[model samples]
Target: MIAARKSLDGLSAGLMLILCACWGMQQVAIKIAAPGVGTILQTGVRSLIAALLVAALMLLRGTAFFGRDATLWPGVAAGLLFALEFLCVAVGLNHTTASHMVVFLYTAPIFTVLGLHWLVPGEHLRLGQWLGILIAFGGIGLAFSAGFEEHGSTSTLIGDGLGILAGVLWAATTILIRRSSLSEAAPTKTLLYQLGVSALVVLPLAAAMGQFGAVSMTPVIWASMVFQSVVVTFASYLAWFWILRRYLASRVSVFSFLTPLFGVGFGVLLLNETVGVRFATGAALVLGGIVLVNVKRSPQPVPV
Candidate 1:
């Protein structure tokens, strides 16, 4: 049996930070490797690699693959959404800065909350949550406006829009999982559906898009592939689920806000992308709004 979960501790906090950093660095990895391996093909290949690992793990654990859980269709839909999300990531990176991609993608929570409010009972938006939605969208508008500035280009704006669409798709996947039979399935099972299906879908799509011809495997490309497949996609996801099983998910999730910050930092440091003050302010608002929307009200502890 699983042990009872506890409040966040120092070790868990530290690990969460590490996980966030790893996730934040994923776009940077993709961008770095894109020159050698076309972005879409690279993403598809990594998904394939990670799917194999997940399948092996499931096999070792004796997890049933063809269970009659009535989740197959939903699982496939989730996988499609997952594929489309990364497709946007792969293509969008070609047009936008990694910093922008990270910020826009993390907006998934906002969209998820909105979706749940309509679909799930008792998931009504609170006043603060509404305010947060307003602020977050306002920030998105402000950030998008940066495209109109002299330094911004049409491609960057398109990439930003794709980033937002990716976030929306991500949110749709989350909602489907929560509302479908997949909610009761094992985490590994859910992951397999996503990874396996994404691999199947994305690889062919990449080929159709003629992205496979750019495969020049340098050490950097190989390293990026290994990191994306092993560390970011495989290990970090498992670690996150492990953390959720052991700690208060609410407390742990709050730390995710740091991911965009880390992404922005990595972009500036590694890619030398410049962030104007307008974009910075917009990002801050988006982060603040996300925190406001997600942070739940907890009753204070009474004196003994």
Candidate 2:
């Protein structure tokens, strides 16, 4: 692998935006198909399909998977976390607007930063970083502070809780992957583990919920599933891994702040969800704080 680049070139920046767009559209796509396919079951089945696609891509690219014995345990653990993250997403989308869910889910970086400060050497944050994290969480509180008396409030609150939980799990999964022997494994293999294990793990739960029979072969469901399995799950991830290999993490992370914005935009446009000033304020802070937390500061001038 190449040493991480210290800056983002034009092409990389463009690619980052494209990938963010892909991620942003994912929730909207799933919500569109949720009527025909039970969200939870659809997620599992979609993941199963993605696993096969990823495996085939790995072979086509001459990439080996699970080649090292040391990677297995951590891989499985990360895979389970990945499954649980999306499970929350699937469940939460049923009760809340997709816009709300995306805002909360992107809080993963804050949680991950806080966890890594003490857990990993060289991962300590400056005061500015801590300030950014607090600002982000403050936005979260503001968004949910006083809406319980409103209609559908109970479901919205529950959805918010699940979305936050999903973010936490996403953070935990990142920590597991970065801290594990899988850090040295191929990106495809790491992704394969997540998709493969998630495919297996979600099946029994889907069965218990009787979600298998919920799937209908409607055009919307088919389009959504195909998009999820092909573009977002497989192509977007491969592009992400490739971009990460070529760009500085900090720069890439800053660009990722666009994802929730895209998600919110798509949700409002596609689903016709009303956005409140509170949500708008919270999303601004969330996106702003993410940019503040991830941006690489300029180096000081050389001494005389």
Candidate 3:
């Protein structure tokens, strides 16, 4: 657990950046691994592993998953929303290119900032912060708009709509976590509920969709699953919840614009995707917006 601090302190900023990077890399990894393991099923498989890991951690920490004190309604809500977010992305990608998915999925922060500001106390974004959000999102759009223009035929309105729905579900997830009783529970236990529910719900749906594709049973695949289970789901999510609790959700949400930039960076390195001047210029605007938004609140001068 992290010590108490003001919103978006140095540690919090560093942690958010790292998590954004992991999520960025994860987009590439899941795309590469999706076909063989099955897109939605792969999420379930790693979710199950992450659930087991969280369950074990819960036992050690004495955070019960099934005791009378369990937060049933909130946990279930979060899990379903979590499941829906990924399901939408997986299914949406079938109808759209990864560009559409990338652009749509990260629109989550906009929804998150709006919803949290309305619902949660101490979670409001100032006008400047809101401006930063818009600027950063615009930069993301500018950075990736080239792809949309270049391969416009590959994306469908239906697919883009589905991806937007996923972004809404993601916003719903954050709002639910903040407003629901799950917020009162330990981070690991909340994580367990989400993964357990996702494994149960998504696995059956994948089976129904005939998405249980044959596995190569390769060592590399197993390693990838292990990495997703451990790094992506377990550690990264725990860090997110911890950070969320430590800071205002709206303040934190703006920084998430970095994820797509990191995604593009890794895509260029790993997939040999070309980066044009738009990408570089957009990346600078995004980073500048992040720094602008998180600029420390001016110290109030108190006088007698």
Candidate 4:
């Protein structure tokens, strides 16, 4: 009963660019607020705030959460993975620059493609996609080698590894959704499951890690929380789901590669983080690979 989805248009493209910018800025926001609030606490609190907003939205939409659908197990699994992903993000950022963290995290698409190729029928990779995978890993190696050059700092390397692990977890979540009843559930429902479960998981984890007492909650930190909870987590996700419903997902996915670029830019502008020439070159390859991995080949017309 769904309408046929269309290719990306002008408005959607612009909105996607805006969305990418918001997503890119997310790491920088976390970094900015980290001085006042520990990263785990920040992530947990924001998830809690956004979960409330999403619940309110569901209430207004009259969407029932406890349906007869078989999404519960998959949803819980996805939520656990989501918690782990952000846990990596929160811990990893303590050791790496926001720019580096963003680049590494956005590698999720490559991992997702690889995972789908293995798990899902009819999702095999083409030559271009294979090339993309190789290029992206090559870039990862190049960037990771930078940590070796630092001689005394293994923390950055550890952070980068966590970032890649987060990407893998994110891909796993996507595959789980695609392979389960959550694929048919309302997008809001899926999102709420992730957010609600993440809040429950991370809050306790943060407390166990002794991350709660660090909260200083300055005006800037509060603003960062608002931006993260309201704008980035709540509004941006809803916009992304709306876009997916309306546009060709493959084409729409291609633009997501821009997120790291925007993230790097925001890190430079706001956080004053430096991007070395070596890292810049590697990030370029990673972005290029991600684009190739997501872009589908257009079919040729047969000659009469």
The per-model lDDT (C-alpha) reads 0.76, 0.74, 0.79, 0.78
Per-residue lDDT of candidate 2, residues 11-130 (tens digit): 877898899888888889988989888888877888888899889978999986746558888989988999999999999999987766776787776677667666754456678767
TM-score rank order = 3, 4, 2, 1
Q: Which is better, 1 or 2, measured by TM-score?
A: 2
- Root-mean-square deviation (CA) per prediction: 5.0, 4.5, 3.9, 4.4
lDDT at residue 1 of model 4 (Cα atoms):
30
Per-residue lDDT over 1-304 for candidate 3, one digit per residue giving the tens place of the 0 to 100 score: 2223246888888899899888887767766776567778778888898898888888888766676655887898899999988888877777776656767888998999889778866566677877788788888888988887766664566778888999899999988887776766788878887999999999998888887756554665676677777999899999988887667676687788888888778788877888889988888888888877787773222111
Q: Which ten residues in a row are the worst by lDDT in model 3?
A: 295-304
TM-score of 3: 0.91
- Cα lDDT of model 4 by residue, 1-304, tens digit: 3334455667987898899999999999999999899999998998999999999999999999888898888989988999999999999999877766776787787777667667754456678877877786667556545544653268887887888888788778877876677756888888899999999999998899888977788899899999999999899987876775555443455457678778877877987756577767877886777666656454322111
TM-score of each: 0.81, 0.83, 0.91, 0.84
Q: Judging by TM-score, tell me the better candidate of 1 and 4.
A: 4
Candidate 1 residue lDDT tens string, 120-205: 54345578867877786677557546544643778888888898899899878877876678756777778778888889988998
Give the backbone clash total of model 3.
0
Better of 3 and 4 by TM-score: 3
Better of 1 and 3 by lDDT: 3
Which 10 consecutive positions of candidate 2 have the poorest summed lDDT? Answer: 295-304
Q: Which ten residues in a row have the lowest lDDT in candidate 1?
A: 295-304
Ranking by lDDT: 3, 4, 1, 2
